[model samples]
Target: MDEVRVFPIIITKNKDSSEYPYFVEIPDIDGMTEGKSIADAMKMAEDYIGTFSLENKLPDSNTKLPRVEEGAVVTLVSVNVSEYKRKNDNRVVKKTISIPNYLNELGKENRINFSEVMTAALKKKLSV
Candidate 1:
């Protein structure tokens, strides 16, 4: 089971031409990132939270929101720590399984990717 947590953030639009368009800051996690659009900013925020979840103790879901500056806009972004770990963690663990010889031959003949197929099956089984 996974618990999703939300973090409060401030977004500042950049008027400079060279730098990224949006600068984001999440005070609770002491995180900051920049993006080119609102969507990118939100995704980066989620990524920052996910990374923080990996490096630190999972904070309480009810953690208080951090105060924002007068000109900055505030928002809450949520990330699923367990889900993020499942998707992003790179340490690999190998598994062994068996399939019908004929099916395996057919897959190989069709150039099917066994690892992709296995991962999809496992993720579906785990409801990930």
Candidate 2:
């Protein structure tokens, strides 16, 4: 099957800060061999669907998976989000932020530039 025939995967930011090269996992398939990233995962899915069709003796074309027969319990697989930000800091985008009064006061007391303090805070939060 072509990449277009496979179910679309969702991508999300990882919450675990300790890990570098922020990674995402796919959950719909029995195993996570497919759909593990925004780009690579999509490619993997295409490969997987193609392999599945070949193994099942189906035409090697983009086609929806056939539904199970009636009276059989179908185990629906839930699609999971897959994506990760690149490990490199070059991916970072600069943005101006408005600091709250309390935060601004804290930065002033700490002898920190308001923007610098906020940038540090963001860096800590993002673990970059």
Identify the candidate with maximal TM-score: 1
Error of 1 at 106 (Å): 18
lDDT of 2 by residue, 59-91 (tens): 323223335434322222221221111222234
Instruction: Give lDDT tens digits, candidate 1, residues 20-78.
Output: 78899988767899888877888999998898887698666644655766766678888
Count of clashes in candidate 2: 0
- Which regions of candidate 2 are displaced past 4 Å? 1-6, 10-31, 34-36, 57-128
Task: State the lDDT at 58 in candidate 2.
Answer: 29
Candidate 2: residue 113 Cα off by (Å): 76
Q: Report clash pairs, candidate 2.
A: none
